[model samples]
Target: MGLFTRLDRASVLYNGMADRLGVGETQRIDQPAGAAAYRSALLRCSACAEAEACAGWQMEHARADAAPGYCRNRGALAALRVE
Candidate 1:
């Protein structure tokens, strides 16, 4: 994929994972730290090798508490998830 396409795909994957984990909700409640973590997780997702798998998984599952093992940002996103 081209640069923009890759970035778009990455953003979609990151948003899907974050939404499933409630990261956006957490960031809204705790702006600074949560936003920082979310941004970091997106950056990691942008460099991940499994963006396509992540997308497929998100589409298949209505909800998920954690990202797949192949996700580089899995741990970080999990930590940011709202309880």
Candidate 2:
């Protein structure tokens, strides 16, 4: 409802989505560009309108090869996967 609350929810969704997709920050965040992308994803998520849908999607997908179509960072997060 509040700014911090929304951001917190976004963070949860973002991390949850990444977890399901088998992506982790430790392998990429060491680079400056990757770090920037990480922050960008969080901010983009914080501003997203599909946060509720994303949470529900994560609940259904414990392990996935890709993010849901509606995910704002779908391509970006996909690129993070090692292969």
Candidate 3:
């Protein structure tokens, strides 16, 4: 994960804290390229060839009006294809 990326326990905890504090940006993965890199590293073991598709799906799914600046995939970056 990137320095700004949160996952598993950190993600859950951060989300909870952010909600309570009304500080959504604190837990957001606003840098899409960075977030995509982190996610690629994290899920590298998976044999799925649909990483880019999955990334796009996540971006669309996480869309919200509250924090338009906050994106789950940072800059809406596409995932790298596994060789």
The backbone clash count of each candidate, in order, is 0, 0, 5
lDDT scores of the candidates, listed in order: 0.74, 0.83, 0.37
TM-score of each: 0.76, 0.87, 0.25
List where candidate 3 sits over 4 angstroms from the true fold: 1-6, 25-27, 31-83
Clashes of 2: 0
Clashing pairs in 3: 30-74, 31-74, 32-73, 32-74, 32-75
What TM-score, to 2 decimals, does candidate 2 have? Answer: 0.87
Winning candidate number (TM-score): 2
Worst 10 residues of 3 by lDDT: 74-83
- Of candidate 1, the 10-residue stretch with the lowest lDDT total is 25-34
Task: For residue 15, give model 3's deviation from the true position in Å.
Answer: 1.0
Which prediction has the highest lDDT against the true structure? 2
The TM-score that candidate 1 achieves is 0.76
Q: Per-residue error at 14 for model 2, in Å?
A: 0.6
- Candidate number that wins on lDDT, 1 or 3: 1
Ranking by lDDT: 2, 1, 3
Q: What is candidate 3's local distance difference test score?
A: 0.37
Please, what are the lDDT tens digits per residue for candidate 3 over residues 1-83? 44344335334432433343343442335535646644553343133344445445435544322322333322322222111
Q: Residue 27's C-alpha lDDT in candidate 1?
A: 62
